[model samples]
Target: MPEQPQWSERTLDMPPQDPWADQPTAPGTVPTPPPPADPAPFSRGRAQVNPQPHHTQRYAEHEPTGIGWPGAEAPGAPHGMTWRWSELRRGSEWTTAAVLFAFVCWGIWALSGGGPLGTPLIVFAVTLAVAVGVFCLARVVGYVVLERQFGRRRRTARGSHLVTALFLAGVGVADLQQTQWVMDAYHWVAGQIS
Candidate 1:
């Protein structure tokens, strides 16, 4: 059998290696070279525990200032008339459509002999007042329901206005058919306009 190689002779043939070869050394021992300075200008690994607010956020906290109404003044109006008009103006288009629909319906009803014959003008005016009041109440209820179910950002559905207008038109047409006087007046007006 051949003789085995000795462990001492194998160690003698290799050069000595240092354990701290990867660590950096300071030149002339000057404050350890300031810890070899961070390789990157910003730390990419760590996350920000406390972040700063954006610049625009500071300005957004302030309330806006401007004229409430332009080119409109109430010289002898009531105390709350301007505020009431502002509220009315700010109402949604759907509410306006509903109020208009109510007026149209009231006119048709009045023209179709819906009120007392003794005092026709008074009856018509009363009917109109009641119709408008009911319609305004209904609009307020609708807005409240929508705001409660959805958020305040919700708007009236387009289909609702279409449906309401179509129904009122149908009612008006039926009422107009029953009233010969209104039909005659309408025809006379159309002929004069043409």
Candidate 2:
């Protein structure tokens, strides 16, 4: 027969293993997680315990001072009767530059005999007509849909339709005359160049 295994009384009475038993601790102290960091003054999640009145006053004092609509003012315009160049330059510097460059290139190409003057002239006429149509459509939509349905009044729309119509009619007459002027100018430049 195999020899019987010896079992000590201390081993028999001992409790099961505790994972945290080896960790150092004071006689009566317990371990705790670290305290959280202080929240920022304007953090999203944290509430403002003490809101500053001066900040609100400062923001209220700064009123918005420029035309709200894009392209509402002429290029290189001053602040009087239109948006200043500084205001228009914000977020639109590249776009403004690109449009001016395109116009310059188009003028050079037209003068260089890229195609018959009629092609670009007719295209410009059609573009002007479409622009006027879209402008009128927008006015109608603003007055009927936005103002009536949404109860948001666009005060400018009241007389803007008449003004825009008159302006577009004048532009149409000018556009018709512009073709002859452009052709004359292009020929004059071509004569000087050759």
Candidate 3:
């Protein structure tokens, strides 16, 4: 049989008082009973605990998102290789396209007046038509495609369309001002020649 292990020798000694017991009773040392709890965060009248302000107003309708806006988790947005039309406008696509088209048309019109086939004017006209047509097509296509893919309209977040329109108008004004300066210079040169 295995021998039983011997228990420790017994000794009598009083347990020391807790060191913190005599510390001057902290103010409000009496524990505050936690306020009676309610199952819900808010309640009214008697027995109410942890009441939160009530909100009864409704929110305006907002567009849903799938790629860029809140609650979007598109596989083709800003991360992976999935063809998305919205990606085009993400990198100044429309703005750049508009500017380029304007530049090309202006160049052709300024370099050569309307004439036969292959003339600068003819080229300018063709390009102008294509650019305008394509831009219109792209705008429609972009809204459709992104709407389908993201489940949300591709409009800007806040006064987006208005802001963009205003910006375009400002740009047009600046361009017209420059054109006026150029035409004045041309007139001055012509006057000198005459």
Candidate 4:
């Protein structure tokens, strides 16, 4: 007869109990509230402010002319003009730079045998046109509205974003196989302008 197999007893070890387990504690272990603030010490330097009407700033009867600073605001600027003029101006500049760079990249890609009307080129031009157009249109609208709403330079504040948007959109149209039309329109417009 084969010998019977032997088995040993098995047991599982439990995890350690948490130190913060619910248990009764001595009253001394409870936290105490902070003492009240001292009256005399807290009252120091808390006196009421005294406002004076005469202390307000006074503007000159006549407006300042450039304030001796070159390229500063000319003799005429709309009242209530805030600092946002600078913001719109800078944003328009960056939009112009991005559109220019996209055009350069598109030209280089086409010259490298990425056929001008190929799917990739069309996609590139159209996508770039849409993106640049949206950004520049927003920029143009912003400065125009800003000037109308704030500064007095509404006539002179037209940004480069308008031209950039038109140029980018024209490239996209050209990519759709209408290059001759774009060139003709461009020449006609140039002739009219000149």
Residue-level lDDT tens digits of model 1 in 1-194: 98888987666653336642444445675443346655666565777688776675553342323422434332322222122443444434654565466556556656567666556556546644654555455555555554444323223344333444444445446556667787798899999999
Best by lDDT: 4
Clashing pairs in 2: none
- Model 4 lDDT, residue 124, Cα: 76
lDDT of 2 by residue, 4-63 (tens): 676763366644478434555568898765467466355546655896566534333333
Q: Considering lDDT, where higher is better, how would the candidates rank from best to worst?
A: 4, 1, 2, 3
Cα lDDT listed for each candidate: 0.51, 0.51, 0.50, 0.56
Candidate closer to the true structure by lDDT (higher is better), 1 or 4:
4
Give all TM-scores, in the order shown: 0.30, 0.27, 0.26, 0.25
- Candidate 1 global Cα RMSD: 16.0
lDDT of 3 by residue, 68-129 (tens): 55455654443232345554445454455455645554654454443454564564466546
Question: Once model 2 is optimally superposed onto the true structure by TM-score, how far is the C-alpha of residue 111 displaced, in angstroms?
Answer: 4.2
- Give candidate 2 misplaced runs (Cα > 4 Å): 1-113, 157-194
Residue pairs with backbone atoms closer than 3 Å in model 3 (clashes): none
How many residue pairs clash in each candidate at the backbone level? 0, 0, 0, 0
Q: Which ten residues in a row have the lowest lDDT in candidate 1?
A: 74-83
| Candidate 1 lDDT (Cα, 0 to 1) | 0.51
For candidate 4, the 10 contiguous residues with the lowest summed lDDT are 151-160
